[model samples]
Target chain A: METYFSAELTDFKTLYNVLKAITFKEYATLRPMEEGLKVTIEEMKCVETSAYIPVQMFESYYVRPQEDVKFKLSLKILTETLFIYGDDGNLSLKMTYKGPGFPLCLIIKHNDENITVDCQIYTMDVDESTDFLCLADECTLNKVVVNANQFLDILTDLDNTSDDLDLFLSPNPPYFRISTTSTMGESQTDISKNSEMVLLFQCENEFQAKYSFNYIKQILKVMNFANKVSISTGETGLLGLQLLINEDAKQMYVEYYITSMFEDDR
Target chain B: MRFRALLVDNAAMKDLLSTVNSLSKLSKDCVMRIVSRKVYFIIPDEDTGPRKPLAWCELPVNFYFKEFNLDGVSQEYNEIYLCFATAMLAKSLSTVKQNAKSLKIKLTNKQTPCLTLEIELASNEGLQNRQLVHDIPVEIIARKNWNDFAEPQFNDFHVSIEMPHLKPIKNIVERMKNMSHSLIVSANNFGRLSLQIKTNMVNLSAHFTNLGIQSFAVGQDNESTVGDGSANESIVTATIDIKKFLMFLTGMQLNHCRTTCSIVHGKMVKLASEQVGALSLQCFFTELSN
Candidate 1:
């Protein structure tokens, strides 16, 4: 099935800010003929998620979709205000999307409320939409598909990571400690929870590789609905994050891996 | 017993002693007495002394200390207040008495139907030696330079006297004067003031207390002609809490003066000393009479 989804960066940033606090990393896949993007955030370790905007109701006002509105449109909003919509109405909130740029689109939904935010993303024009879809009767899915260039733009500008651990765990057998450092960028940066970071380490085989901090942060970010996380490691430093995506169902597990970038010497 | 580190520095030892005496007027609980002298060592006798002497004395040693208390972070600093008083008194006395005709000055108003400075510094025994002295109301003299000092003379402030071989008091006075930078620190009502002073560079500050010193401008946007540099000096500021000092400043209604502290960048600098880095001064207005 070939489906297309599109939205704005402002929409995604609003959604990211709202849900990022609830989930480790948001998972969105494009489904042909679907109304918009489908974002599923795993729920397990609430502590893993750094972004958490609560769901609420609001006073009057309604949004109408323009029939002639252009599809596949992307725009960067640089205003300080972040717009959020509740079950009742749309209102501004205290949040800012900071990375390399201003416009971002990755909206998530819960109940009748929908959320998105704007992060200035820098990328040469590219396409990343996939026709992958999931069907569920009880669970709620929220998403916004914005221009791929806007998302790629943000990825390209981020030449450095944006987080640090107070200290490193001792390196046993396969795991070797690399440099544990922080940022000293030129411009005064607004330290945001949504900032992208890369965690590096050297290890033995595929199973021995320690989980990257980014992967852990991402999982903890999206699957915050659960209380605990069970981690399993395998061949060549491959860390498996086993998470409970739903509350009532404990048997269900969503998994992902930290791909070898080969860019890091360790 | 944890004590506050009080460092007082002035040009004359007599002046330093007098300041210590002034504090006695405020509170009698804290007292300053000489503990040791230049190479002279006064050991306690096995005999519990025919009579217990109050002040320890001799040539070469001079420091008077007192306990300082705030909410309750007792430091028990060593040679703290005494070092200050000693330096100041040495400087003050060095200025007036050059050749040393016995001079008398009152240090404290005590019914010393008792203790004498000489008895304490000299013998570990009997009513040591005595010299009758009159209290001369010394006029407050304005010093033109910071290094100016006077010689030590017997003051009527309940003190004892003794003449013995002593090192050049001038060398000692000069050393104490140079060491004065470590005693005075710049702090405020909430916390200790902190700043990093570069080598040989004088950092000038005019705080809120010195607001009335319109003649000495600080924090102005204009470049100060005092040194050659771009007017735009980088300033790093941190927040501090100095509630005790604030209460004292407010209660006293003092017009703090502007101060400039810098290192004497020469070959003979003591790198290991604690006063090497940033030194700050909180200058308060003394009686004006040049």
Candidate 2:
């Protein structure tokens, strides 16, 4: 069979670290395009996360002309393979995939120690049932961009037992207010638009929604590595999070979208 | 039958203590088969499943002890086999190994069959020396089951090579363990070693080249097995339990010029060191069911 995709790259630990953030799920979808590669993992169809790796990340990349290649694989197994050599050494990676029914082949080289690894991970046909989430046309929108660490700090302070979290966003005194109730009591945290941590604020309309705190907390690992976070809410209450990660001045992006939990409306 | 020994040399005590420590990591129950020449530590088959011996180690009696004495059952049968808990022996040895002027071991009948360990600790200051005694119960094995504890014999190997640094191999095996239960260990005459793990989802392997082939020292009926060029080029593979292999790598720490691994095709593997300082060390791992 002809090779559909092949790429040679060094510094694979960056990609490994990025995939680890979304490993709460076992299988993930990998799509190789001319622009770059995209990894998508979702939790119970309620939350969705995707990571994009650009073509520049590889030293050399090739794809059979006009071939749309996508496959499903175990994310945990792939990450463990990438990290098989360990973290201390500088490992160069060569990845390849043929057409359908072929395993993803990875050749890892540790030149400093004169050791090499060959990994072949069988790929499965992608399940097309996943519905890509986006902001609907008729929904009201409230977008807030803030320092990732500061937003994460506020999230960490919230009560872990609270299942439902109320998010209120507007152009009011408290631009963003997060409140939740538990057996202990009710807790509320407010972040104003005037705060120095707020990098960008845009309000198309007022948006209020209740989200499952567990889904929001699951992707905190991605946020911890982000320099800035873009949070937007839709009228029907779809929470969208975009993380901007800057390492050694190279920018990377991680995106998440979670549907709000409305008891009576659902 | 009577068996007793005394160890006073600090270096010999340390060697015996180190070997006991390794044995403790191996198994709980141990059989001390004493003859006039040497002592053997035999690890019997765990359950009633099969009769394959788990491990067998030899310790020369006169080399490790200052005073060695043994009285066998009869003139024809000149060996005594006694079973004891290995952890208890290692515990006693480690406690008295340091600062003890002399350590004595003797078989005594204290209520049950007990092996008494008397330690004479040398005092550093002007104070008088202290003595500590520990009675470890043992089971005297009858001659009927003597065939079960036979020594493992060396045989022809398809591939024999010096093992690489174990630290890296251990690290990689640990990672692979999370992915699969068993792994494939293969080596070629081209001086290459590879470990592989295969699952329904993935097949991952690590390869190391430029290793030196090991030949056993002469005088043990160990003749060269490599016949032709084609025979030398072929690869020998073994599918073994990753847990047992990892246990061997971590626990078997013998000081030698190099650790040699000899594989008998898909049957078994033998890891041995010609000289562990003054002691000889060897062990075997049987193949796992596919």
Query: Where does model 2 exceed 4 Å of error?
Result: A131-140, B8-18, B45-48, B61-63, B72-78, B90-102, B115-135, B215-232, B254-257
Question: What digit string (tens of lDDT, one per residue) describes model 1 on residues B1-290?
Answer: 12222212222334334333323222222223221222111111112333221111222223321212222112331221111223333333443322222333323224421111210112224654333332212122122221122112221111011111112211221222221222122222122122111112111121212111112223433222334364332221321112211221222221222222211111010001011122111211111111
lDDT of 2 by residue, B210-246 (tens): 8997642332232334557555345677787787677
Taking all chains together, each candidate's TM-score versus the true structure is 0.19, 0.85
Worst 10 residues of 1 chain A by lDDT: A69-78
Candidate 1 residue-wise lDDT, A72-117, digit = tens: 1111111111222212233332221222122232222222222222
Q: What is the TM-score of chain A alone in each candidate?
A: 0.29, 0.93
Query: Could you tell me the C-alpha RMSD of candidate 2 in Å?
Result: 4.5
lDDT of 1 at A183: 65
Top-lDDT candidate index: 2
Model 2 over residues A1-266: C-alpha lDDT tens digits?
A: 77989999887767788888779899998888898887888778778888878788878998887987889899999888888876657778999998799999999988877788999999998876664434333233767899999998989889999988888887876778899989989999988888989999988566788899988898788788888998887656788888887766566778888899875653
Model number with the top TM-score:
2
lDDT of model 2 at residue B26? 77
DockQ of each two-chain model? 0.00, 0.74
TM-score of chain B of each: 0.21, 0.87
